[model samples]
Target: MLRLIMLATAGLLLGGCLQEEPAFPNVDLHGRLVVDQEVTGARQAQGIQGEYYKRVLSVNGQDMAFNDFVRHYCPDSNTRNETCIKAFRIKKIDDVSGATRFLPNGL
Candidate 1:
């Protein structure tokens, strides 16, 4: 029957869709910055100095090198004029030992 064939096709399509893996893994490594930012100047700079953006409410991915994590998430801008993104939690992957460490901010 046409109806039976359509149902089978629909079932196969749904099954295939369901079997697809997520593009980004759902994970919160619960990590924070290891070092604190140094504040020396204006209100804008001071605003960024406080031990904020160190909370591990959410994280992006699973495996990442420490240096890579720093380069990606660490705030290096001194101007502080432009609207910048607050750092997110990063689970740094150790290069030497291949160890996973979650550095929680002791704010």
Candidate 2:
């Protein structure tokens, strides 16, 4: 009898844990950025360009905003150094239109 009761409780708990469907439908969006870093020499009053972040594989598979993705995943430091993360795949999410795209990086 105790085993039966335990089983029933477990089933109920599992059922409650199930997540509800999102009100806003999700979709994927894909794009790329030609990243370049420019530095201003205060003394020289001239701008020097550093090695630009290239071929940044961008995808919206997890449905994160552009800015959010940059902050959470592709931080500015990462862009500058490319050492924050060697490789990552993001689920693209469009804020205004509500679209989704998954562009996993091969690198």
TM-score of each: 0.28, 0.28
Model 1 stretches with alpha carbons more than 4 Å out: 16-28, 36-107
User: Which model scores highest in lDDT?
Assistant: 2
Off by over 4 Å in 2: 15-30, 34-47, 50-107
For candidate 1, the C-alpha RMSD (Å) to the true structure equals 13.8
List, residue by residue over 1-107, the lDDT tens digit for candidate 2: 99999999999999999854323222222445443233123322455333322223344445343454445544444343232233223322222222233334642
**Residue 98 CA error for candidate 1 (Å)?**
27
Q: Tens digits of per-residue lDDT for model 1 on 1-107?
A: 99999999999999888633223333333343342223223424757343322223233655553444445444454423121112222322233222234434531
Q: Score candidate 1 by TM-score against the native.
A: 0.28
Q: Per-model C-alpha lDDT, please?
A: 0.39, 0.40
